[model samples]
Target: MIDETAEQLRERVAVELERARARTALLTDAVDDDDLIRQHSPLMSPLVWDLAHVGNQEELWLVRDVGGRDPVRHDIDELYDAFKHVRADRPQLPLLGPAEARGYVATVRDKVLDLLGGVPFEGRRLTTDGFAFGMIVQHEQQHDETMLATHQLRVGPAALNAPPPPPAGARVAGEVLVPGGPFTMGTSTEAWALDNERPAHVVDVPAFFIDAACVTNREYARFIAEGGYSQPRWWSEDGWRHRMEADLTAPMHWQRDGDGWAYTRFGRTEPVNPDEPVVHVCCYEAQAYAAWAGKRLPTEAEWEKAARFDPATGRSRRYPWGDESPSAHRANLGQRHLAPAPAGAYPDGASPLGVHQLIGDVWEWTSSDFVGYPGFAAFPYREYSEVFFGPKYKVLRGGSFGTDAAACRGTFRNWDFPIRRQIFSGFRCARDAEPV
Candidate 1:
């Protein structure tokens, strides 16, 4: 017999699973069969692949892993195994067509839901606290964000729409000083945090001054105007090589037009808004821009300390503002707006140190490379985080407007190749604080 607490958790997990499926439908429904199959870039899988991959992961964890059931479609496992197939190669595989993929996912979800009704939440670590269900929800939501990226890359009229974000209010311009101290870095208590965020550890961070808000297009444009790309001093040797090879002059989707800048977003080209936070920039570009501006990108530790540390209590809150869940007033999240709110928006979401937009708007690139915490151990699978721990990828913290609550916790870690500019990424600058 399940206790009241366990029953409540089960119900919540069921609802979340359905909600994820609903969101997936919205993304897939917006485009037609042809759109689903079309690969927007070599960097991303076709939308239909992501659609079915979501279902495959759900079935793998919920039905086979948790429920101990026979594989519904064991033959197609390799086709959907993310590690087994690369994004560029997926199109050549014997992929299920749009209608067939939808049907497969629908059938898998129905079975998973039925299993959830009776699956005990206490038998194993994965089942305990409904962690498996939560993981699946986060997985689907992650894919949803990926699909949204594909939408942005697709060339056509806008197929998705949302109202513009609220206007920015008056914001004090300056840096927030975070005192040198020890603070908790990761979360061991978050019920659904991924393996990468597990085994909470303490970090000793030095005093530093970080930007109060994300770097705006106006600010980044300064770097471009000063011939930041042509100047090799600001960029690392590798970054300089990549920059010269790609011949990049501005952020992705941007072009110079008669002493002004124009950018494409969600299939619409318009004048770049100088006040808005710049998005779609890679870590290398961010780093170079920081160097040109006489600043540096904050380390992941510093970024977390700024976002989560409460100086008065010396405790890390679940978010920058507090332990409260995110909402429209607190942050611009869950794809409510296609673009970031203007800089200085979300005053209420400011951290204890008066840092704004740390939890949303765009994924902030950090100076840290992707690595596991002390005493870290993979759960349920190693391919998720263990395989990616290295210098090849840089870490990105803070969730983006496209990020969902399930995957947007303060301890959550995102990593990508430094050359990846297709993601909704941006960065703020930091500097060493002067000693008293």
Candidate 2:
């Protein structure tokens, strides 16, 4: 998936722009002037600033940084170059007002697109500037998600898509039984894997049972109703403390309204669509729920084993269904611009072991911390792994609904701060082998 073609890159950028445009529209309508002023503080930028920032970063990195284009505005280099300094220092800068800043952003995006249309994609030097374009696309993608998260935080639940009604059929909860065997656990050379996924090697794993599907809202609610939130015994020390400090009684978007639970999703508040996968939960929350269910989150290795067929082969696949790219019907991505699709919507996209939606819909939580593979090395973006290899972060596999399929692969690993739940994140569970 990493070795995406130029056309794929262009399409990805266009889709991201559409997502940004939609979220911007929502923020514009939802945010009052006071809210806008508050959103502009050092902690977080206003929605207007966020929109402009996405456009500016794309233009600065792709157009000016790579294409050698002139700046659309003289002060752009000084007023809004977020990459020029430490990220923490960004919010403290003197920023432009909403109207002019937004206009400049629109101009920059148009110019960048025009430049992209003219540039030769295949033979150019894949230099710092070239990498910058990829980074900017990913950066804007991240902001699109953040905009949704902040909007939910500020304005209650919203769906990234139309919430499909609850699952019509009976829920199937079981595990895919894996036989004991030797597996090539690490990444291989066939794909554009990060350095952390390199130095591929073989690993032998014992027989295990993994969940057939990601943990669902219905299942998690049973835990909650059974005093899962009140019981410290179900939580790890870190998880317990996290709950106490945050006073989190439910998932980030979850709230109670009478006997049933409701969650803020995709720009609207709706009932906890019981059949949908439980989403936007942080690592600790997912862990706690797994514990409550008398199970554990799958290790990154286990997750990869389930999602990937031949680890040693290093077969580059965009989705678990093979080298095929994403489609609306294959999974819950890019469909009418919403949050999550129903868990079972993508039977055709299932892994060989029948793991549904492994590559799209939501990022699945893994038990493994984000560390380098055996014999790790660094690449051009040196900070990609070294700075985040510490204990606090964890690996998340499978791309979310908002991610481009090209960026989602068997070996394509994504890491996140354990407690950061701003993205469209969710989890599945695994359990020890049952006694014969």
TM-score of each: 0.98, 0.80
**Which runs in model 1 stand beyond 4 Å of their true positions?**
1-4
lDDT by residue (52-90, candidate 1, tens digit) is 999999888898989888888888899999999899999
Pick out the ten consecutive residues of candidate 2 with the lowest summed lDDT: 163-172
Residue 314 local lDDT, model 1? 98
lDDT per residue for candidate 2 within 1-436, as digits (tens), equals: 3666767766765665555555565555565555543453233455655666777776766767667988776565655554465434654566666666667767877777677655655555443223445555556656655565555556533323454532323344678876556666556553334567776777666667888778888888898889988999888898889888988887776889799999766557778777778888889888888888778998887787777664445442445677666666666653234566666766777777677778777899898888887788786456657778978889998877666543456777889888867667899988867667
Query: Could you tell me which 10 consecutive residues in candidate 1 have the lowest summed lDDT?
Result: 1-10
Model 2 quality (TM-score): 0.80
Please give the lDDT score for candidate 1.
0.91
